[model samples]
Every structure is written in structure tokens, then in C-alpha cells.
Target: MTPPPTDKVVPLDELGDLVADGESVAFGGGWFANHPMAAVRQLIRAGRKDIHAITVVGSVDMDLLAAAGVLGHLSFSMVTLEAFGLAPNVRKAIETASVPFTEYTGLGLLIGLEAQGRGMPFLPYRGPFGSDLPARYPEIYATTTCPFTGEELTAVRALQPDVAIVHALRCDAEGNAQWDGTSGPDVDMAKAARRVIVTCEEIVDRSVIAQNPHMTKLPGYYVDAVVEAPFGAHPTSHIPRYSMDAWELMDYAGQAGTDEFGGYVDRIRSESEDDYRARVLTGRDVVLAALVDAAETLEGANL
Candidate 1:
């Protein structure tokens, strides 16, 4: 995988330039898979604040941002650390009233992003009427009469994120990304956001991309910047690449339980990407080590 030109390809340190201050943001991946952790780290290191983070189910991405006190608002159905238990940072933020937030059903969040992607003002969603979400977050979830059936439906306002970022298995020199497993809301985020950033494990030749065009989840045109960041989704699984680093996640969960979350973030932010790879990711996989080397070489050239 050769490096793409400087016009579209950027080093991880330069990622902040693509996003402005106090803008809404959407992230790709679900649960603990395919998250753009490397880019997220850069965002945190850059001191980005007042961000409105949007996702159907918030996980480590949301937890990290909230812990750093960078997020001003959140739009999600729920925040879970998954099997690790509750996301302490989000819980603390809400309990302390640190950030203004909204709660919506999983379907409601998806429909909202979809509406924004399609350039619609609002999307009609059914079945959330049984819950109290409509009464609680009326600003996000509203009720409207169906023109034909006259059945009342929940209207979810469109969410146009200022910037969206995603992690991919591979991308061509032109920024066509290939994601191996479930896409979740990544496609919607790409379409809904004004700008898109793609962080990938490797850069394959354009010919490889042409062989299986069907696998290209994010077309090049939508992507504003392409970064080669192997192990970019570290601590999170990337399907065919590797599984989640439960040890690191457990460490995070442990730190998040106390006031040591800032120390945890500081330690990681201080380490070089190579040091992080040796300490966390390269214990059993030599292949991942090779990929990391390749990605570093590409990123170093830009730096």
C-alpha cells in the first residue's frame, strides 16, 4: 500500500484542521468495533471543545470525549461500556449536569441521521410512542399526524453533523474505503455530514479496489481526508484484522470508575503510536506489526 498524495492524505496530527471548533460530530462503528480511536485521540489532544456528539449507541468514543470534558452535548439512545458495565464518564457528566444531552430510541437516532442524509426536514418513525421519549425530549422527538392513515407517528428531526469520521479496513489512493463487517450508521454519517474523514489500516492499490467495487462502503468523493492509521481502531475490534483488546478496555473501565480517567488519557496521549503498538497490540500478531510499520511509514512521510 503506497501513500496517497498530500492533497487528501494527512498525518494523524493534522486531523484537527479538518474539523472546526464547537461543531457537531458523528462517529462510525457500533459497540466496540471499527472505531476511529487514533483520530479521536488526536481530537482530544487538539483540545476540541463544545462538540455535539451523535451516535445511535455511544461507547468508548463517547465515553472518552465526555471524560475529557470536550463534549458540550450528546445525542444518543444510551451509553454503555458493554460487558464492561456502564460508561462512567457519561454517567458522571449527566449526574453532575456537565453537558446538555438528549435521549432517543435507537430507531429514532438512525432515522434522524437518515433524514439529514436525504435532505429531509424530518423523518416519521413508529413504535417509540409507547415510551416517554416524546414527552421528555420533545425537541428531538415530536408527534405528527400521518396524512394517509391518520395514525400518529414520531417525527425525528434531521441531524446534520458538521463532521463525521470512520475507520476502515483498507482504502485506495483515491479514498474509496472498504469496511469488512457491519457498517452500522457509517453510511448515513458520510452522507449526513458536511465533511468526512477516513482512517484506514492500509492503502491498497486502486486496482484492488476496482476488482470489488461492491465492498467500497465510503466512496472517495465524500471523504475530505484519508489517513493511513493501522491499529487505528485499537481496543476495538476490526473483524478480519483483529479482536478487541479487552485488557486495555478493562484498564479503561477501571480508571473510568475513579478520578483517574484523566491520567489514563494522559498516559496514552503522551505515548508515540509505535510505543502504543508494542505495548498494547503486538503481543500475539506479527501480521498486525507489519501493517503498523507500513502505516507508520506512510504517515511519517507526510509528517
Candidate 2:
């Protein structure tokens, strides 16, 4: 008889302990969907600093970290708040040259992670033609010729982050994570990272995960730790469970880059995750869940 598997479960507060200052960290999620906001908050609350953040399409998650003075370097394809406006903190940091940054084309960034996941030094593809990005980063991008056809292709170097944090719908104690919707770049980012931390709305027993194996995107072997954080992706949408808290985002947008922004960051730093939920998510959580139900109802009616 085999002994029980090691329980990878950990408290959210320990998230900061896994990451070191100045280490490259790949944040999972894209375009305000399923970002590890809980972990992001924990990092700030723990007073972690000088993080080198990487994202494919970031929004508030990146901006909040920037506002908290946690970022020393940023590498990304895009960081926008969509209807709210640009990511003010990131933009200001870049404009002031306070945070060094590298801007990759969206495809280039994904391919770089893919290269690492596949154990390759680099991967070649028909990259963005006539884009000035290639010329700017010679070390990352280069023109290569196919040995057989002599066709010119662009090559992207591997991008392996020191750690990756992703939000899942649910995970087991052994760290098997499942996502009901909008996994985004979580899989690729997890694959390319040296260590992975999974924060989920709930942590179930291994039997629960086994019941729905199809939903398990990241197996336990790839995950270093599992954190149970209900509403882990608040403000960012975690489909099927709840929609984004647009009101919170709008409020954040208004305060960002203003004198009040420091207070906002300070509140997050001072509170526990439970306190944050109590303060901001109390009455709003129900409405956010209703929004998801309403959208699904509309979609079903349309069908």
C-alpha cells in the first residue's frame, strides 16, 4: 500500500515567501480574466519588492503591483485596463524610467514560453512582418533561414520565469488545478516557470478532481503549492462562477494615479485577504454572481 500523497496546501499569506525579490515572475491570466489577484495582494501585503513581472495582456493586476512599488522590471505585450483607460501606474513608471521594461509582441511572448515548455533553445515562426519590435530586441528576436527550404523565419528565445502564479476555479490538496472557463495563458506560463503556485476559489479532495479529470489543466506534478482563496480573481472575471466586479474596476480606475491611490494600496497592504473580501466583496459578491447567471441566461436564449 502506497502512503498518502504529500499535501501541497498552503495559506495565501505564504505566497510571498515562495517568491524572491528581483526574480522573474510570470503572472497568469489575460485581458482581465482569471488573474491571480489574491496572490498579487498577498505579495503587496507581505511587503515584497523589486519583482520582475511578466504578462501577456495584463490589466489591474499589473497596475496594482506597480502602484504598490513592487515592480523593478516589467516585460509584456500589452497592459491595458480596456474601457477604464491605460494602466496608469505602469505607464507612469515606464514614462519616468523608474521600472525598466521590455515590450514583446503578443505572439512573440507566447512563443518564447512555448519554446521553453518544449525544451528548445528557440522556436521559429512567421513573426510580425515590418514590425519595429524585432529590430529593437536583437537578443530575443532574430531572422533565421530554414535549412531545407531557405525560407526566412523569425526566431524567439525561450522565456522561463523564476515562478508562476495562476488562479484556478478549484484545486486539490495535491495541487491538481482545474479551470471551468478562461484558462488563458495559465497553462503555458505554468509550463515555462521554474516553480508554480496555484490559488483557487476552493480546494477539493483528490477524488473530486478525479471525477472531473477533463477540467484538470495543471497536474499536481507541475504545481509547487496550492492556496485556497475564494474570489481569488476578484475584479477580474472568473467565468462560470462569477463575472468581473466592474464597479470595483471603475472605482480603481478613478483612484489610480490620484492621491487616493496610495491609500488604496495601503488598505490592501494592511488587510488580510478575509478583510479585503469583507470590505469590498460583501454585498457585491452576490450581484457579481448574478451577472454571470444573467449573461448565461441571455446566451442560452440567443441560442
Candidate 3:
């Protein structure tokens, strides 16, 4: 039998160098969902800077990067913890004018990425005219008349990110990744970005991927590197695998504006995924324990 090619499979640490120091970096997943946190930690640890971050509605991933002082510019719709209220680090940075950022509507961001993916110079869209985005993000949002209807439309400039980092539920050695749920704008970002790095919960055999071709969200051709990282989306929900660690997120949020935020980043960088999980749960995470117990029960029953 012949072995499969694994040229794209790389170490977690390699993610820092895959993208240069000064470049545009986009993150996958929605607010507090399916974020590639493990890889983000590595980049923060590497002391990377001068990054222009583009996020399609992000949370802790963006906050952590902001807290590390790596980002020089940011483009996103919003970064909040949902019911947890505003993201502390982001609020502080914006208030101090430490990191200049532009706010876009969620649809505006998606259309911009779509333009880049389709290799178009710009994409024309409706709405957002009544919003303050036109005045605030004038550089990104411009007025153009539709060729067919002769009506005024908003033209969202293409968003061609230098690198896109996303988390996948599973992938093959060749870097073919399949996500489980709520893909969000990750696929568009992967296609539009010049480089893509995928960190997955597990790397399965190529045959497993072949059996379900439709599940393959990101093909190997677009992926520059793949890192097999279990619990890679720790503290965020991966869905069908494990839920988000709300307590840990709250804890981080509570210490966001203080010096303790740096301590949290240091601890995240210093500890392994398992150690972090153990520490966050602290032998008292009933929700997680119940989920694990239920999964084990189902597995045993199936076996």
C-alpha cells in the first residue's frame, strides 16, 4: 500500500512564521464560536506585531490578540461576548486609540470577502446607506450606480487577507478540512485569503475524508498548512464535540482591562491544552463532566 502525502501538516508553532510580522490576518468563526485559539496563542507567544486583523464577528480570539498589542489595525462588525457584554480589551484599546479600527456591517464584510474570492475588483450591494457606515468607513464603502437598474448602490472594496487562520472539526493529512457546525464566513475567508492555516481537532485517514466528500469545506489546494490540535478551540464552542467554557470566558472578561489580562495571556501561553482545561474546570465543571459522561455512555452503547 502507498502512503498518503502529508506535506501540509505542520507543527502548531509554525503558524507564527507562516504569516509575516506585518500583514493582514483574518480569523475564522463567529463571536465565541469555533475560534482557532491554540494557534492564536502561538502567534501571541511569538511576539508578532503590526498585524491588520479582519474578523467576521469575533470575540476572545480578537480580544486576546488586541490584549497582546499585536494588531495595528482591525476590521470587523463587532467583538462582544453576547450576554457577557462588551469585550474589555477591545473597549480599552479603542478608548485609548491604541489600535485604529474600522467597523463594517456583517453583510458588508461578507460581500467584501466574496468579491475577493470571485476575483472581482469590487462588489455592489444594497442597504447600509442609511447607516453611519458610509460616513465612518468611507474608505471601504463607496457609492456606485448599478449598471442594469441605474440605481445607487454601495460598493464594498475587496478584502484580500494575507492569511486566514481557522479551526476545523476534522481534516486529513493533505489538509482537507470539514467543519461540524456554524461555518460562518470561514469558507469565504479561506478562499479569499492568499494563505490559509487550519488547526483541527483531529486528523483522520484520507479514506475517512473520501467517504464523505461533501463534508470537505476546505480542500487541500487552498490550505497552506494544517496543525492537528485537539481542543484547539478551547474556551469556545466547537459544537457536537464540546461546548464553550463560559466560566473561563467570564473570568477572562472580568480581568480584561486590568494588568491581570497579561497574566492570563502568559498562563495561556505557558500551559498546554490539557493543563489549561484542567485548570479552567478546576475539578468542578459539572456541565462538561455531564457532557463527557453522556458521550462515553453513548460510545459504550454503540460499541
Candidate 4:
């Protein structure tokens, strides 16, 4: 397909300025699946409320935002990452009847994005055909019939988001995003979005994009903002830079309650992004000095 004409690029903050209340937005990544939620976080911080937040699946990245009530509607395939935070907390939130949401199976949601990307109203799939979910979700399920026998069948709804935030290995000034690792539904979700926010580990010159166009997962036309955010994935990934820490994630998972989470957020909020980079994110040390110091002081432990 031909790329959209004229790439519209802007700073991350300026991009957030465009977001308004009560808009349904599709968010890419599974619980911090190496995709930085910083841009999305900024939106939440900017007093933006009543926003519809959709993910192919949930991860730790989403826990705080949903719990904080920044989301008006929470839609996704599932509620928790078995590797990270426990599932019960989010499931409890949904079951409270206060949160507005509907769940679709993984394959159903993925095909929805593919359909939207192709500009189709709905995408048909084989599974979830005889399940109770289709009849349960009219917004996602449309009626169909067997092409061979002309019998009734079901088709799932197309997935589209008002905004899709995608973090990647790199993106160019023109907004061409490159993903060098396992990408689930991010690429297709970006294409299905009305506005695409591309946050890259680094933004390079257009020449690099031209050198290997095939490497780009999503073209500039499909993307709106080109943000250079290093270590943006945090507990998720900084792909090719390092792998995710399941142990640290498990530790973080055990730390319960909103107060603890608020404390972490409070601590991180004290520094600007520059401070984070200068002190920790961009350094070339054997270990983060602060982490080492804390580890040394662990109760009943030897370093």
C-alpha cells in the first residue's frame, strides 16, 4: 500500500497537547512490553481523564494508570502479565462494575487491528465462532454465514484507536519506526490508529531510513510524533540494549498497595528526564551505584 503523503511530526509534549478528554485511544504493548509508556504517562499526568485505554494485553505499565482512574474505558485481551504483577488486583477493578470495559481473545483483538489497518469495518476469523463472547460483544462481533453452505456465522469487530503510542528500537525524523525485536500487535495497531506516536531509543537522520527501508516496521506517514526517549521502556525493555529482568519484576510485583507505587512515582518524579539519564540511564558503569548501595544494605544479607 502507498504510504500516506506528508509526515506530521512534533515533540512529545506538543503531541500530548493534542489529546482531549473522553477519546477512545488504543495503546500498544503488553504491560511494558519493551514499548515505552512515557508518552502515555504524560497524557495521564496532564490532567487528561475519561480516556479510553486499550491494549492487546495488560502489563505492569498499565497498572498505575488504570488504578488512578485516568482511564474511562479499559479494553484488552487480558488483565495481567503472569510474569509481573498479580492478576487479581486488575480483575477486581474490572469486576467492581465501576470500570467500563470488554475483553476479546488475543487472536480476536489482533485481527481487529489488521482489519482496521486495511480500512475495513470488520475482520472475519475462524475461532471465537461458536463461543459465547461474540454474542456477548455485539460491538466486536458481526453476523456472517458460511460461504460454502450459506449458514450463519460470526465476524469480529475491527480494532481502531483514536491514538496509538508505539515505542521502538529507533525512528527517523520523518517518523518511520523500526522495531528490532519481537513485536506483537504494535505495528498493526499503529497503522489502525488515527494518530500514531513513535518514541524511539534514538532518532537518526533520514539517510539511515533510506539505507534499509525494509527494516522499518511502520512508515512515517502512519506516525505522527517522533520522540527520542531512552530507557523509556524501564522494567519492560530497552531492546538490543538489554533484556527484561524477571527477578526485578517479581520483586516489584510483591510490593503492594497504592502507597508503595505512589512512593516510587514520587521518587522518580523528583528528577527531570535529564537527571535520570545523567545519573543512571546513559552511564557506562559496571552497576548502577545507587542500586549497589541499596543492595549492600539489604536486611540480613551479604553483598
Candidate 5:
């Protein structure tokens, strides 16, 4: 087993400057329904091109990035399901660009992540017992072999990234990051990247993390940049800071992931950095109150 070369250490802010043209990036998020808008925002601000993107499933994040005129390729397991699949904006961009996007089987992509973390060239995945993707992605299936089948089986190669940008609920000044909620693609995300930059809500004292180690996910040593950014993943919920905008999410889903994507773009475009800060200052309490309203308004369109 051979692993890809060791990735170099770099700061998160430097990420926009460091990533070489055509480098690959593995994003850590849930299904298309679950992604970090702040992380996506950072990438959009940089607006790099010819980069590969990986997500378990993505709707706005992928669509927004693609619309920003970046994204050379995409590799994923599933886009959307149990809600809505294939974000409309993403689909339109894919259709417009004719990008050679590939969907890896879930199990195969997991195996690839396992291999990448282990510093292995590749690893075998047994899922996709019967599927067309294996045949389409020969690289993943390059050396398909199976002791059970006694026939060659296809498998995707473990992949890593040049950099990964993820948001954490809290962290220490040294860059130890953590989440305050359920598990996410965080571990795979950090492992898959040569460097990781985590934005946290509250960058606390290191000892505070030591008292409750569960709060910190990746170690400070592994992190390059730890931006103490509160309300980072705005309109996207911050767990304790906010709850999922069920109605908003459903609305976005109902529109096939495009619903008001352009509207969001325009909204952001209308505001400059100063405007953003002013908006944040004024909107903080309003946003908090909205989060408090939660399910009451979830039933109606007051928001």
C-alpha cells in the first residue's frame, strides 16, 4: 500500500493563496441538506478555479461555488435524497459546463477515505455490489478484485485534498476545533486534507478544552488557521446558537436546491464587507430571536 505524498502545512487564510491550480479539495458536510455556508463563503470570496470538490451531498455549497465560476470537477456519493436530490442550481451549472462529474458509491468513497487516512495508495470497497458507477470510474476500480467473487471487482482510490475549510462550534486560540452537535464528515474531512482551517464560534482557553476534551475534534497541531468567527454559518444554523431552518431548508429543497439560490447570491452581492458587518451587528438579535421562534414560524412564512 502506498499513500499520496505528505501534504504541506499552511494557514487557512493562506489557503486561497496556497492551493495550486487544479488541486483537489475534499469538503466535510452531510447530505446536500447539510453543509457549512461560511466555509462555502470563504471559498467563494477567494474564487479559485479548476479545483476538484468532494461532498457527501451538497446543494447550495456546490451550486454557489460553481456559480462563482470555480469548481473544475466533483466527486461525491449522493447529492440529495429523503428530501430532494440534485440541486437545481448545481444541475444547471453541470449542464452548462458539461463538467465530467462523477458520483462514487457511498461505501467506495468511505473506503477511499479510510485508505487516504492510513497513507495507503488505495483500499477495497465492497459496496456497489451491483452498480454502473464502478465501470464508469475505472480509476476507483483500477484493480477490482474480490476473494468472494473470485472475479475482478472495481474500487475507488482513497482520496485526500490540498486543503479543507471547515467550521467548528468552538475552539482554543491554538486552533483545536470541535463541534457541539452530532457527528459530521469532520474526521474524514481533516484526514483527507493536507491542511485544515477551522472557524469556531468561541476560541476559548486550551485548558477549557482539556477539561472537556470531547469539545475539540481535531488537534491544534493539525490546524493551520483558527478563525474565531461567531455566527459563521449564518442562516444555516449553528446548533446551540441556532436551529435548523426547517421551513427554509424545505423551501430550498422544494425548489430542487435552486429555490432562491440566485436571490441569496444577489443578497450577498448587494452587500460589501462593511455592509456585511453592519448587517451582522444589527441582525444578530433578530437572528437569535428567529432561532427562538423556531417551529412556531416554521409553519408559516413570517420569516
Candidate 6:
């Protein structure tokens, strides 16, 4: 009999073992969608520290890491909580200068990842005109001329993260990941990182992935591990699965930056991933799913 394929699946708790402390980690998600939050929580529970976090358009994930005192540095184009308000913990960290940061223009950050994915030392673009960002980071951004046309352009250094963590809709035991909704920069982040960890809402057989190959954004070859973490993107949204937990987020916003915040972090730190789901998701999960249905219904009505 033929041997079974390598099973890359691991328990969520083991995620911390795959990543070393003080490594640069690219977090996958944008504007509160599909962040590998379960992994983030696991890191906190494991007491991992001094991590350099990179995000394209971060929200609660970045703030929670900051609040947990897990980040040594942050690199991002934007970090906001949208209607909930600015990311309070990130703001405090930046204002206090406690954590060093590199602010890339949105496109600059993505291009940097793209450059690494293409195996280039750097990539050139038209650059963001009238933005003070380029001048601020002379080391990361510089003027370059195209050899063919002699046209001036801005070159951004390639960004390679030590590890990338992303949440997916589902994945096979072999780590083939599928995303039914917004994938954001998960693919690019995975491709550019030295190691990639995919946390999915469900783990299925290879046949399920084969049936929907087009949805397989990150092939198993690029994935280092697959973790099954239902509601992995809680408080954020994974769409087609569930909507953002606005109520929970509002509670988080209210507690963030307050004396109560430590208690909140402690609560998470003290609980296992299973405990967290039992406490926060047991009853509310159905409601969260209904919110997605309600949103789609509203969108259809508008259309």
C-alpha cells in the first residue's frame, strides 16, 4: 500500500513552537478580515515576545498584539479600527515611542512583498507623489532609473518575513488552503515569508480541495503547517462564514487603553483556544453567522 501524504496539520497550541521569538512576522488580513487571530492568541498564551509584526491594513489583530506587549516593532501602511475608532494600543505605542515602527505607503508595502516573491532585491514603481513617506525612510525607498528608458522611479527594498500567519476558510491535511471571501494579501505574504502557517476554520480531505482548486490560494507546497481553528478570525470577519463580531469589538474598544485592558488580556492568556471558543463563541456563533446572512440580504435588496 502507498504511504499517506505528509500530514501538515498541527494543533493550534503548537503554533507558538513553529515561530521563534523576535522574528519578523507578516500577519495576513486587511481591514478586519481573515487575520490569523487564533495564532496571535496562541503566541500571547505562550508568552512569546519581541516580535516584529507587519500588516497591510491592520485592525484589532495589531492592536491586540500591541496591548499584549508582544510586538517589538511594527511595519504597516495603516492601522485603524474603522468605525470603532483608531487602534488605541497602537497609538499609545507609537506616541510613547515604545515600539519602533516603519510606515510604508499601502502600495509600497505590497510591492516590497511582491519583490521578494519574485526573487528580486528591489522593485521600482512610480512611487507615491506628494507623500512624505519616501523621504522619511530613505533606507527603504530610493530613486532609481530604468536602464531601458532612463525614466526615474522609486525603488522599494524587498521584504521577507521570517514567518507568515494567515486565516483561511478551509484547508486540507496537506495544508492546501482555500479562501471563499477576501484573501487580502495572504498569498503574497505566504510567498514572501520563509515559513507559512495557515489556520483555517476547517480541515478537510484533499478531495475537497481538489473539487474547488480555484479557491486554493495558497498551495500546500508553500504552507509549513495547517491548523484547524474554527472562528479563527473572530471579532474580525471571514465572510461567507461569519461577520465581524461588532458587539465584541465594541466591548474591546471600550476596554482598550483602559485599566480594564490588562484584565482582558489576562483572560485571554489564561484560557486555551478551546476555552476561548467555549466562553465567547458557544452561544454567539450562530448569531455571528446570521449577521453574514443579514448582510448579504441587505446587499441583495440594495442591488
Computed on alpha carbons, the lDDT of every model, listed in order, comes to 0.81, 0.94, 0.84, 0.69, 0.64, 0.94
Query: Comparing candidate 2 with candidate 3, which one achieves the higher TM-score?
Result: 2
Displacement of the residue 257 alpha carbon in candidate 1, Å? 1.7
Candidate 4 lDDT by residue in tens digits, 118-192: 999886667666677767787788788788888775687787789887788778877888877656677888888
Candidate 5 residues lying further than 4 Å off, grouped into runs, are: 1-15, 18-21, 32-34, 81-86, 142-154, 246-274, 277-303
- The sequence of per-residue lDDT tens digits that candidate 5 reaches over residues 1-303 is 866423233333444664555877776666432255655665555667887887765555676666665688887776543354556656766677655587877777767877887888887655576677787877676656777877765556878877776767777767777787633676677776787777666677767878889767787777766665555555455665665445555655565454456676555545543355466546554565466556453466676
Span of ten consecutive residues with least summed lDDT in model 6? 294-303
Candidate 1 global TM-score: 0.89
Q: Distance from true position, residue 138, model 1, in Å?
A: 2.4
Candidate 6 local lDDT, 1-303, one digit each (tens) = 979977999999899999888999999999988888899999999889999999999999999999999999999999999999999999999999999999999999999999999999999999987898999999889999999999989999999999999999999988899999989999999999999999999999999899999999999999999999999998899988999888889999999979879999999999999999999998899999998888733345554
Decide which is better by lDDT, 4 or 5. Answer: 4
- In Å, residue 22's CA in model 2 sits off its true spot by 0.8
The full ranking of all candidates by TM-score, starting with the best, is 2, 6, 3, 1, 4, 5
How far off is residue 125 in model 2, in Å? 0.7
- Candidates in order, TM-scores: namely 0.89, 0.97, 0.90, 0.82, 0.77, 0.96
* Error in Å for residue 245 of model 4: 3.7
- Show model 3 residue runs off by greater than 4 Å: 1-6, 272-278, 281-303
Candidate 3 RMSD computed on C-alpha atoms after optimal superposition onto the true structure: 4.9
| Clash total of candidate 3 | 0
Off by over 4 Å in 2: 296-303
Clashing pairs in 1: none
**Model 2 scores what on Cα lDDT?**
0.94
lDDT of 1 by residue, 1-303 (tens): 966543577888888777777999898888887778887787887878898888777688889988877799988887888999999999988899989888878888888888998999999967576787778877777889899999988898998899989888888767898987756788888888999888888888878988999999888988888888888888776767777767778888988968666787786667766677777766645554344344432345554
Clashing pairs in model 6, backbone N/Cα/C closer than 3 A: none
Clashes of each: 0, 0, 0, 4, 8, 0
